[model samples]
Target: MEQKQFFTEKPRILIVDDELGPRESLRMILKPYYEVYTAKDGISALEAIKKNPIDLVTLDLRMPGMPGEEVLKHIKNFDPTIEVIIITGYGTLQSAVEAIKYKVFDYILKPFNVSDILSVVKKCIGRRYVSGEIKNVLEKTKRDTKSHSEIYEQITHFLNQLNESCYYFFRRENYLEFVRVLATTLESKDPYTVGHSERVCHYSSLIAEGLGLSPDEKEKLQISAYLHDIGKIGISDIYISKDGPLDENEWAIVREHPIKGIKIISPLGLSSEVIEGIKYHHERFDGKGYPEGLSGKNIPLFARIIAIADAYDALTIGRPYKSPLSKNEALLEIKKCAGSQFDEELVEVFIEEIKKNDREINQMH
Candidate 1:
C-alpha cells in the first residue's frame, strides 16, 4: 500500500526497541512512508533524536541500559512537540497509565495489528505536519513586518493547504491543545505574563460554572479565554514587557492587539462566538473600551465572562506599569468596577466563585 505524502519532506520516524525482530518489523512497516531511523536501545535513541529531526518514536518500554520512560522524559524535555508511541510486549495497566501521563500519542501492546499501527502512525504524522505548518505561519507573521492584509493572506493560504485535513486537526482535543501551544508561545514573549492565558481560562471556567452555562458554551468560552490575548503576538516585545507607563505611541500599538488578534484568527474558520470573544474581551460594560465600545449585553456573552476573568488575572499578576495586588485587593478592585469595567451580574458571580475557591485559586496563582 502507498501512503500519500502531505509534506515536502518525508516525516521522520524512529524505532527504538531492544529486540531485533520487533525493531526491524517496525522499520519495515514504516520505512516506505517515512524517513525511518533505528535505535537498538534508549541511549542510542536519544542520540538519534538529537542528530535527526525525528517527528515520531515507537519505543519499547522494557529496553535495557536506559528505560524507555526515562528516554520519553528526555525527549519531552528536549522538545515536547515530538510525538511518541509505546509498543511493548510487557505492556501493563500501570505502564499504559504512565505512558499517558507523559503524553505518548498511543500505547499499544505487543503483536499489534498491522492496520492499527498504520492508522495510528498516519494520524500522528498528519498531526505533526499540521503543527509544523501552523508554527511556520506564526513565525512568518512575527518575522515579516507585513501589513495586516498580508498576514491574513498568508494564514488563509496555509488553511487552504490543509484541505481535508482541517477537520481532523480541529477535532476537539487536538484543537484545544494547539490553541494552548499558541497561547503559551505568545506568553513566552513576556516574562511577567507567563501562564497568563491558562490562569485566565481557569478563572473564566469558574465564572461559567457559577453562571450555570451549558457544557457547549463553557467549551467555547474556554477556547476564547485562552486565546483572548493572542493578538498581542503581533505587538513588539518592548510594549509587552515594558516596566513603565507606555507613551501615547506605545499605548496605541498596545491597543491594536484586539484588532490584530481578530484578523489573525478570523481566517482559521473558527466559530463567530470564539472570534467575538477574542475581539471583545477588552471591551468594557460602560461603553469605554477599545476596538469597539460594546456596552453591557451588547458585548458577546463569552467576551463578557472573559472580560471579568481577564481583568482579575491582570490585577493579581500586575502588569509592568502596575504593582501586583493581593487576591483580596484584586477582588476588591473588581467589585468596585462592577458596572463600569465588567458586566455587573458576571462580576458578582465571579467574585462569589473566587471566594468559594479561595484556597485552590491561591494555589493556582
Candidate 2:
C-alpha cells in the first residue's frame, strides 16, 4: 500500500481562468490537499476574494476583458498577502520577466503534469505565507519608523521654535506648526478643527502656565492641548463646523476624534500621560462630556486643568458662525462656568494667572 501525501491542512486555492478545462483540471489535481475556488475572470476573482478567503491563486496569463497582468496588479493592490502563480499556455521569457516584477510566486508553462503543478503550488503557497508575514512585519516597522521620524520632526521643530525670537510670542508656535500641517493635509475634511486646535493650544498654554505648571509640564500640556482637537481631522468638516448645530448623524463624527487622535498619535510612542491629557480634556467637573464623562477628581489632573483652559480659549476665540468674546467677558464666562463646567481649583488658578497679565489679554489678537 502506498502512503498518501497531504499538506498540514487543506489550503484554499483560487483558480482564475476564462476556460473551464484548466480550472477543473487544476482543481482535480490539487483537490485532495486543497479546497479549490474557481473564478472565470478578474472580476469574479475579486468578488470571490471579498466573499471568501483565498490563500493562493493560480492565474492564467491571458483572459477575455481583463488579462492576467491587470488582475495580478489588482490582487496585489487589494491584498498583497495572497500568492499568485502565473500560468501561460503560450509562455515566453518576457512574460516570465513581467511576472517576476509583479512578484508572482511562480510561473509555469503549458502541458504540465499533475506532479509538476503540485510541486509549484506547494512551493508558491509556502513562500506566500512566509513572505506575507515578512511583508507585514516590514510594513509595521516602516510605519513605526515613519512615526518616529514624525516625532523627531516635531521635536526638532519644537527646539527650533523655542530658540527663535518669535517663540516668546507664544508657547505653542512650534507645536501648532506641526498641528497646522496635519490640518492643512486634512483641510478638505475639517478646516474648522484645524483652527480649533490652534485655539486650544493658545488657551491651554496660558492656563497651564497660569496654574504654575513646570516648564516641562507646560510643554506637554500645550502639545496635548494643541492636539486635543487634532482628532477632529478624522471627522468630516461638513459635520464638524456645520453652520447650524450638528444633527445626530453629524454629531457621531464629532465624537470619534479622541479615539482617532489616539490612534494617529499612538505610533509616535508618546507617553501615556500626554495621551490621556488630550483624551479627557473635554470632560466636565460636573460630569457632562462626550466620549468619556468623568466628573471631579476621577478625571486625570492634567485633563481637568485643560478643560478650563480649552473652554476659555474656545469662548474667547471667534468661530465661523460666532463672534469672539472680549477678554474680560470671556473671563467672567469662565468664572460663571467654573464649578459646573470646569474644575473649580484649576479655574481659580487660571483666573488669577490671567488677571495679572492684563496687557497680554488685551493684545491676544
Candidate 3:
C-alpha cells in the first residue's frame, strides 16, 4: 500500500502568468512569506505542480497555448485540494464565470490591489502544510484511469481513488468529524444499533469534562468513544443486523470488532491512549476481559471511561435482545457493574454529572 505523505511544513505557492511584469510582481509580492514558484505558461505550471507540493496557485487566464480554462480543468482533475485563484484580464468576465464551475477558490481581476491579493492568499492557504501525498495519489489515479478508455474502468478507478483519499485525508487534520462520519457509516451497516456510538461519545465526554480532563485528553476521549465500535464494521454483512440471538460462532465474530476497529484507525496517526480506548472499551474492571484482559488500573484510563459510556448507552437503548432502560434504570444497571465492568472512580464522576443536569439526558422509553 502506498502511504500518502501530507504537508507538514511552510506552505508552497505557485504563480502562473504569461506576461513578464505581472508574474514577476506577483512572485515578489508573495516572496517574503511563502516559498514561491513561478511558471510563464499553463503547461509549465502544471509540470511545476507535479514536481512539488503546492498549497495555492495563482494563474493568468490569458496564457497562449494552454488557455487558463483548460489548465484549470487539468489542475482540478489532477488535485482538487490545490487552491486556485484566477487572474483575469479585461473583458474576460465570461471566462471567469465559467471557471467557477471548476471550483477555483476565487478570481482576482487584473490590476489587483496588493493587500487584496495578500488577503486572498492568506485565506486560500488554509492549511500549514500542502496535501502533497493526496495530490500524488490523485495524480497517479487519474493517470491510470485516463490510460483506459472504457467508461466502466474509469468509473471504477475513480471510485477506488475516492475511497482511498477519504480514508487517508479524514484520518488526519479534522479527525473528530472524521470519527463521527465513521461511526455513521458503521450505523448504516447495523440497523439495530443506530446512534449507539455517538451517544457513547456524548456520555463519555460528559464524564471526562467532570473529571477535569485537559482539552487534549478530552479530544482523545472524544475520538476514542466515537470509534470504539468501528471494528464491528468489519463483521460479515450478514451478521450485523440479524434479528435474533447469535450462536457461539456469530458471537465470536461480534467480539472481534474492537481489534478490527483498531486496524481501521491505526494509520490515522492517533495517540496511543485513543488507540487503547478503541481496543479495550469492552474490558472488565475485575480483570475478566478478552483480548488481553489487564484488569483494575491496568486497563487504559480512556478505555475505562469509554466502557462506562458504552455500557450506559447499551442499557438505555433497546437492542435486539434487550428492552431500553429508563435513565434511572440505566443508572442503576451501571452502578451495579461499577466494580466489575466499569471503573469505580469514573462512574462516580458520571453519576455526579447526570445528577447536576439530569434534564438534558434522553428519556427514551
Candidate 4:
C-alpha cells in the first residue's frame, strides 16, 4: 500500500540570530506571510528544524557556538530544497558569499529594506528548488554593484516561473533515530532497564501482528512503543536511583511521566495514534489508571497494545524495588489481570504470542 502523503498548511520560516532584537524583528516581519520561528543561536536553529519542516531560513551570518555557514551546510545536506537566504552586515559580505556555494537561495544586506526582503521572499515562496544553472551563477558571481548579476536575476525569474515548491514529511527519519537514542539514554539511567524500551517495541510489534493490526497500525505502534517512556528522561536521577520503594510523592512524580511524555513528543508532528499511545498507555481497563482513567475501548487501541507490552517488559525485567519475574510467573500475572490491567482480547492474543515463543519472543523464551 502507498504510504500516506503528508502536507503542511503554510511555509515555515526560521529566523536565526543571536541578537534577540533582529531575530524578533524578522519574525514579526515574516509572521503575516509565513509561520515564523526564531533561534537565539545556531544549535537551537538546527533543533527547531529537526522538530518541524522549515521551508526557508533567513540566517544571520554570524553566531556563536555553531557557525552560520556550518548550519547552512547541515541544512543543505539534510534537504537541499529548503531555501536559505543570508542576512549579513556590510563587514560580513565575504561570509555571505561563502554560503552561496552551499546553495543559499539569496542574500540581503543587514538593516534590510522590508520591500527587498519581501520581494525576495515573495519570489522564493514557490521557488524552493535550486537548479544547477543557479548554483553556477552563484559560483561565477563577481563582486558587482547591481546587487546581483544579470544571469542570477534571469535564473531567479526562470525559477519563479517554474513554481517549484518543496514538500517535506513532518518528521525526518534521522530525527526519529535521534529520539530512539534519547530513549536509550533514559534507560541507561538504570542499568537494569537498559534496552527496556527496545524490548517493549519488539514485543509490541509481535502483539500487533497477532491482533491482525494493519501494517499502518503496526508501524505507528512500533514508533509509539519506542518513544513511550521518553518522559522518564526528565526525571531526576535521584528518583530513578532510589533503591527502595517510592513514597507517595515519588510515586506521583513517576505517574506524571505519561503527561510529560505527551508534552515532549507533541512537537514531533506524529500521527494522532502515535501521540495518543504515548499519552495514554498507562491507562487501565478497569478505569483505575493515573493521568486519566480512560477505561475499556475508551483507551486508544494502540495505547492498550503498548500497555500490555510495557507491563510484560516491566515485570520480566524487574525494577529497583522488585526482582524480575520468571517467564511463567510474568505470564501468569498478566493472565490474572487480563480484564482489569489490559485489554481482554489483546491479553489473550499476547499470551498466545508469548507462548508460541516464535522468533519475536526469542529473548523471553
Candidate 5:
C-alpha cells in the first residue's frame, strides 16, 4: 500500500489579482513560507489551479476581467478543499454576503495589515493541513483491514509531519476545536457512545472542582477527557460496535486504544499532563491495568480523575454488550473498586459532587 505523504514540502499558494502591486505584495509576504504562485487574471488563475496543487488562494474581488466571484465559484467546483480568502478594495455588504455564499475562508479589506494577512493565512493553512491529514487517516482505515501496529505507524508519521509543518502557527483555540472535532468523529463510530467524551469531560470537571484544582489544571483535565478515547478511531468499527463479548484476541486489540490515542495527539503540542492523562486513564489503582500498571498515587492525578469519570459514564450509559446500571448502582460499583481500580480520595470527591448535582437538579425540578 502506498503511504500518504503529510506536508513534507511547503504548502502551495496561489495569489490572484489584476493589480500588480497587491498581487506582488501578497507574493512577497507568503513567498518565504509557501510555494507561491500568482495570476494577473481569473483565466490565468483557473489555469494555474488546474496545473498545480494549490492549497490556498488570495483573490482580489475587483479584478478587470473574470470577476472574483466567478473565479471563486470555479475554484470551489474544481476543488472545494482549496481555501480561498477574498481581498476586496471595493468592499460591499452584498459582496461580503456573496463571499459567504461561496464559502470563502475569510474576507479581508484591501490595504490589509501585514501581520493580519500573515495570521489569517497561517490559520487557514493550519486548518487545511490538519483536516486533510485526518481525512487521509480515516479513509485509509476504512478501506484497509490493516493491523493495529500498521495503523499506529501511519498515525505517528502523519502527526510528525503535521507538527513539523503547522504546529508553530496553530493557535490554542484552533487546537481545542480540533480536539472537539476528533472527539465527535470518534463518537460517531458507535451509536451507543454518542456524547461520551462530553459527558466524561463534564464528570471530570466536576471532580476537578471538588478537588479545588487550579484553573490551568482544570483546563488540562478537560482537554484530556475530551481526547481520552481518540485512539479508538483506529480500532475496527466491527469491534467497537460488537453486540457480544470480545474474545481474548479482540479484547487485546481493543486495549491498545490508549497507546494509539497517545500517538495520535502527542505531536500536536499539547501539554505532557494532557497526554499522560489520556495514556494512563485505563491504569488500575492496584497496578493491574493494560498498557502500564502503575498503582495507587503512582498514576498521574488527571489520569486517576479521568479513570473515575470514564468508568462512571461507562457504567451509567447502556452499551450493546451490557445494560447500563442505575445511578446508585453505578456509584456502588465505583465505591467497590476504589482501592483496586480507582483512587480512594478522588472517588469520595467525585461521589460528593454527584450528590451535589443531584440535589441541585431536584431543587430546580
Candidate 6:
C-alpha cells in the first residue's frame, strides 16, 4: 500500500520531541487540520504508534534517546510509506540535508511560524488523501467490470492484501502493546505474572533449538509461547488475580483460554501450525489437560515444546500465590512432571541446553 493509504479520515500525524513546549505547540497547530498526538521522546513515539494509527510524523532532530535519523529508519522499517517530516534547528542545515537523504518529507526549522507548518501539513494531507481516493476508485472500477463471481474473488484478494499490509504496518507496535496490556493487566491482578510472556518466548525458542526442530517449527513454537496465554486476557480479574487456589468453577473458566485465544486470532490467517500450538499448549503429554485431553504424541510437537517452557517460566517466576522456585528446584519440579505434564525427552534436552549456556542465559534475560 502507498503512504496515502493510511490516511482515510483526517490526516493523523504524530509529533515527536523531547521538549514539551515544542511538542504541544506543534499539536496545537496541527490539531486544526489533522489529528495530532505528541510524544515526549522517540520511545514514547514508537509506543504511541503501536497503540494508534499515524499517517505522518513530524520529528525533532535531537532527542536524548533515539535521534531523528534512527526514528525515521524505524518508522520506515515498520511501514516504508509512513511520511515523516524532520524538525531541524536553523543552523542544523547538515542534519536537515541528511534527513532529506533519509526520505524525510521535509525539514522545518525551529522558531518557525505555525502557519508555515500548517501549510506544509495541508499539502501532505492533500497528497495522501487524493492518492488514496484514486486507488479506491481504480479498485471499484476493476470490481464493476469483472464478472460477479470473479469480482467477489477479486474483492477477497484485495481485502487480504490490505489486511496483510496493515498487519505488518502495525504489527511491531501492536504486538508489543498487546503484550504490555496483557502483562500489565495480569500484573495488576497478580504481580507474579510480570514478564511471564517474554520469559516464555525466550525459553521456548531455546528449547526448540535444543530439540533441533525445523526452522518453521521453531518459529511456530516461539509465536505460540509468546501468545499462549493471550486468551487469559479475556478471563476476569477476579479469577486471574486470586492469591488463593481457584475453585472448581474458576478453574473451568481458566481452562477455556486456549480456545478463546485461538478464536481471537483465527481470522488473521495465521499458519495452522501456529494456531494448533496456541490451542494445545496447555494439553498434557498424559492426557490430563484442559480444553483437550490429548495424550503423548497426539499433542502437537510445538505445543509440547511450549508446555515445558511455559511451566518452567511459571515455576521460576514469582507468582502472587506462590514463591518462585530456584532454578535447580524448578528443574527438579519439571523433571517430576515430565511424563505426565511435559514431553520427557524435550524436558531433558531443555535442561541440557540450560546447563551448557547457563551464564549466557542469565545475561540474556
Q: Considering summed lDDT, which 10 consecutive residues are worst modelled in model 6?
A: 176-185
User: Candidate 2: what lDDT?
Assistant: 0.68
- In model 2, the clashing pairs are 189-237
lDDT of 4 by residue, 268-326 (tens): 55789988999999999998986789999999998899999999998998888888999
Model 5 clash tally, residue pairs: 0
lDDT (10s digit) by residue, model 6, range 213-249 = 8876766666677668766655665777788899999
Runs in model 2 with CA error above 4 Å? Answer: 1-195, 360-365
Give TM-scores for every candidate, taking all chains together and pairing residue i with residue i: 0.74, 0.48, 0.55, 0.52, 0.61, 0.56
Stretches of candidate 3 off by over 4 Å are: 1-173, 359-365
Backbone clashes under 3 angstroms, per model: 0, 1, 1, 0, 0, 0
Best prediction by TM-score: 1
Give the per-residue Cα lDDT of candidate 3 at 308. 90
Off by over 4 Å in 1: 1-5, 15-40, 50-52, 58-64, 76-81, 84-127, 137-165, 352-365
TM-score of 1: 0.74
Q: Which candidate achieves the best lDDT against the true structure?
A: 5
Residue 333 of model 1: what lDDT? 95
The TM-score measured for candidate 5 stands at 0.61
**Residue pairs with backbone overlap in model 3:** 231-261
The full ranking of all candidates by lDDT, starting with the best, is: 5, 1, 3, 4, 6, 2
lDDT of 2 by residue, 1-365 (tens): 01012234567899998988888888888888778899999999989988887889888878898878889999888888788888777645468557977768778777668878976776665444433433444355446664533533443343343233222222242443343334333332344444565566666776777767798787777667666765654454566667877788777767887777776665444567679887888788888875687888888877887777777766777567877899889989988987788888888877877776676767864
Which order, best to worst by TM-score? 1, 5, 6, 3, 4, 2
Native RMSD of candidate 4 (Å): 19.7
Clashing pairs in 1: none
* lDDT for 177 (candidate 5): 47
